[model samples]
Structure formats: structure tokens, C-alpha cells
Target: MMTGGLSETKSATPEIQDMVDEVKPQFEKKSNEKYDTFEAIEYKTQVVAGIIYYVKVHLGGDQYVHLKILKPLPHTGEPVELLDYQTGKTKDDEVTYF
Candidate 1:
């Protein structure tokens, strides 16, 4: 049986790091500050029309940045696209045990 869930990494791979580097300029432009490229707290890879890397980064001040990196298949040698970029503050929740 396979338990489907998000896989997390404390450290980033070269591919992920490269994607982050490429998108940093735009992210900084939009947010008016540099993104914390130190590490990725979590990530997921999805295979659709192409390969997609979903990464979550903590930018301090309760802010979290989510990035989606997409690459086309068949080796067209095209640049990867930052399909989606979003930021949100973390929320706290309480859990109850029964």
C-alpha cells in the first residue's frame, strides 16, 4: 500500500536550487525583498504535461512562499517557467483528541 502525502526536504537539490535562483529576481521584484534561498522546507514533484516542482519556502515574519517550477518534456531546451508564485502567512490551529 502506498500512503500518498507530501514529501518534505530540509535541503534542496541542485535542480531545485537552480530553479530558485532563476526565479529570485522576479520574486524580489514583487515582494520588494530578497527571498530566503537558504532552504526549502517542503516540496512535491508532479508529472503532468511536464514535470512540476512545488516548493515551499519560509521567508520569516510568518510568511511562506510557494513556488511552482515547470519544465517541458522531449528536451526542447526551453527555459523553465515559474508557473505559480504565492505568499501567505501561517495560521495556528488547535486539535482535539477523542
Candidate 2:
């Protein structure tokens, strides 16, 4: 994959799902909505100074959200950050760099 370009979207693996779980609370806080069911469905990755994960999440039923999370380089000793997100997405929505 290109260094600065987004990787092809892929189904969420166990690792990806764990990453989502780590940031779920932050997402809920930012969106001001608690999702009873938060599931990571698919994702795209980009490599910068760190890794940027663009994840498509299922919030049960027809509801969905896109999350942009940053996992700093391991040596930075930084925590993964919930950078931005878009709500009202759907199962059919493509997970992009936004």
C-alpha cells in the first residue's frame, strides 16, 4: 500500500474490532450518543507519522458511523486518538479518508 494513500477497504478483523472498542467511549462522548451495539464492519488504513484508521461501524439496525482514529507511532507512547467522525452513515457507505 502507498504510504500516504488510504489502503483498500477490508473487513474488520479481531484487531480492528479491538481498536474500535478502545475508542468507542470517545466516539460516544463526542457524538453525545451511547450505542447499545457498536460493531466494526470495515476499515481503511493510511500510514503517516502514525497510522490513521478509517472505520465503518454498525450501531445496530440501519444506523452507522464512520470514525477516523489516529494511532501514534508506538515509540511515541501516545494513546490512540479519536480524531473525527461522521454519523448517519449506512452499510453501503464507503469508508473513506474523511
TM-score of model number 1? 0.63
lDDT of 1 by residue, 8-55 (tens): 433467777777778767667777887554355556666666666677
Model 2 quality (TM-score): 0.97
lDDT of each: 0.61, 0.94
Clashes of each: 0, 0
Candidate 1 collision pairs: none
Each model's Cα RMSD: 6.5, 0.6
Query: Which ten contiguous residues of candidate 2 have the minimum total lDDT?
Result: 27-36
User: Which ranges in model 1 have alpha carbons more than 4 Å from their true place?
Assistant: 1-11, 36-38, 89-98
Candidate 2, 1-98: lDDT as tens digits: 88999999999999998999999999989888898899999999999999999999999999999999999999999988999999989899999888
**Who wins the TM-score comparison?**
2
